[model samples]
Target: MIPSGHPDAPKLSPLKQLHWSKVPAANTRKTVWDVSEESIKLDFNKQILDRLFCSKTNMSRTGTHSTLRNQDKITIVDMRRSNNIGVLLSKYKLTGPWVVDIINSMSDEHLNKELVTALIKCAPTSDEEQLLQSYTGSKNILSPVDQFLVEMLKVPKIRERLNCIQYKQSFDSLFEEIINGSRLVERCCQWLLKAANLKQLLHLILNIGNYMNSGTARGNATGYRLNCLLTLSNTKSLDQSITLLNYVAKIVSDRYPHLLITSDPLLEAASRIHWKELSNHLVSLQQGMMTVQKEVERQQSTVGMDTFTTKMNQFIKSRLDHLRDAANIIRGVEQLYDTVMKYYVEDYSSPEEFFSLLHNFMTMFKQAHLDNLRDMENDKAIRPKIVHKAERIMCQRSLSTTSLPRVSLNLAPQQEENQDTVRSSAAAAAAAVGSNSGSSIQTKSKGLIKNFKNIFLRKR
Candidate 1:
């Protein structure tokens, strides 16, 4: 943390502030020791001086103190011009204790003609450089801005700040996500591979699809698109009362119950993640691990960083590296899923789409099975009534056929005798009417009587 009144105190972005809010406390239970950089500048300066003196003694025959002085000046100049070091200073902020240590550690032997030359370029023009020179006092002509930038370029100090600030927390968060995401993907893959029910479901659908397309161009298709499962409910039976899917569902429920159980394990997988999303997570994890590895390497080479580096290395080996094997399994799972999709002629190359497809199929398949059971129940309820009605119609037909012959033979002769009797009564009524008509009708009746008497006499 920067001190309250420091002029170079770096302002934090809202995003970075929020990120730091969730960071584990620095003093929490952790394996890596956070070193006290309370007097790092003084300590590092003494080390540098001791090293420089040893080098001077070793090269006493070949060079003077002037050569060593010139080498130190070149190092300071290189720091001032480095764009990478400049960027790190901007990103991590430069107002902390690390910045103070770096700035105060510099001495006149390290500052030389090149440092003055680089400082001249820090301002826009000669006029500004000269104007700024007054701020640092005449004895020390480098402007405050130039001096600040020069101090920030101290590689060892910057490295130490980076190592100390957020490395452990960042590594911990990234490693946890990678491990969890990889494990999820690996589990999903296992469920898919071992799903006995999913395999049978696919096989059943394949056979049905081929049967439906028999004698057509599609009859010999090796497999069907996974999306075709969605259309199963659309396959109408011959009577148009039920779908083909209903029949298949009934068969599965009754005959192949074991095959459907495979879907139970995959239930979580379908609900929780998509294939593409999981893949992307794994990729990000790989990149994050690589970054942590680079950070560890950087800190390992820096002097006075052994404790942090050792713990960090141990953490990676024990906790994070196992994810590499899981990542490999993820790759294999992707390939297998892709191959299965291709076999079915489905374009679903990602887990996201595939899981959704499977979900839809399962839902429809179960619904179809239930519907078929309902239809069977209805058929059972109506069968006895239909049978009773049919029997009643058969009995009525038999009675009508048997009575027809009896009506013709027994009733025909009686009908002829009744007709003859009716004709005789009509003739008697006509004779009575003629007797009451008077003389003309009486003469005609007498003539008819005489003719009848003569005919009776001849017959005798």
Candidate 2:
């Protein structure tokens, strides 16, 4: 449920506030938002970092790419003018305590002044930071920088960062909070699966799916998205994955309709989309669409230039306008489905083993939980009625059954009348409909087909 404004909501921390505050800027005449977009985009670089840090042969502390003494510290910053992330190291590494060590002695105002002055001199939001970045400077300036630096700012990533900053209030330990929240939420979801009534669990899943598709949820929704996929990934091993995927897919396909992307950031990334895998979703509908077009073609007999695009569109949807709409949905959802299948789907030879793994996974989830949702099953009983509706929809998909065009034919009685009369009558009708004069009939048919431009053109 969407929450009403909470009057006594706790204040956000500085870092959290900075990352997520949506401050409205007044416009001279036009309404303009004075929000700044600052973010860090991670791509294939993380894989490299993971290689360097997490490698078995690595000498770094834990799985970090950079090795520093325990006394050393690193800072994560955003100094790239193009809205990319930046990293700076202090030989050791920077922790909360280290950051405090650097500026704790200074007054809050003084610290603010130094940070602001450093930000101003380093780079504009649209410009590069030359201070910590230059190779041959005076060793360093008197300010801090991130431990890692990356360049590249996707417009969507920037928008996401801005939205996160605006919506998420700072907590004491954001990382811990995220970790704790994620584990507890995922675990509670599992308990609800077995303990609660089927309808209740479905509602929770639907609600989470909705949160994913909503704009406000884009910030923290990734955690849950990952959680859900990871939970479902073992389906092949546990038989739970396929069943749950079927259940979840049915629910989303039937009810939510927007669960594949929106709030799921990883799904929004470009390279993650798999066009071939998603092709299965269109097969059933395309059959219907084909039937529709065949009838239309038989009746009108026309064709057009966008024939390929039209046929492909009809492969997923029937009506031209609905085809356009469905295309948009497919394009938007494709990336997400690709990511899920790529990361999660596993192969299994038997269903028993798969379900065994699922039970083990649920056990692990229960142990990892940080927060306890009381009477999860009981709470689920209070779930909105929509869950039941969604479940029913799962069994009887509206798309599965479609109305086909009715073909009507007139039948004159084959009475025991004179056989010659029947033959003559049939012969006359055939002649009128082009039984003889084959070449002339062909010419007339050509003329008729020529007149039927759309049918010939739009090969539906």
Candidate No. with top TM-score: 1
Point to the candidate with the largest lDDT. Answer: 1
Candidate 2: tens digits of C-alpha lDDT, residues 379-447 = 577675667676455323312323323322222354323333433433333343344355665454344
**Which sections of candidate 1 miss by over 4 Å?**
1-167, 170-177, 180-184, 187-197, 237-240, 254-262, 289-320, 335-347, 374-460
TM-score of each: 0.42, 0.15
lDDT of 1 at 109: 44
Candidate 1 yields a Cα-based lDDT of 0.53
- TM-score (C-alpha) between model 1 and the true structure: 0.42
Residue-level lDDT of model 1, residues 1-460, one tens digit each, is: 7653343443211111111234365664453443446535443343343443432232355543233221111112233444544454465444334544532343334333343233323322334334433444332233234555444444343433343333443445555555565566556655666666687788887887888799999997877667777887887888987787877887788888765432354554554665566667667655756777777787677654554466667766775655676577677766766765564466765665776777777877777777877888999999999987875554334323322221221235535544434334334334544445566544544454345334434433
User: Pairs clashing in candidate 1?
Assistant: 197-259, 275-351, 275-352
lDDT of 2: 0.35
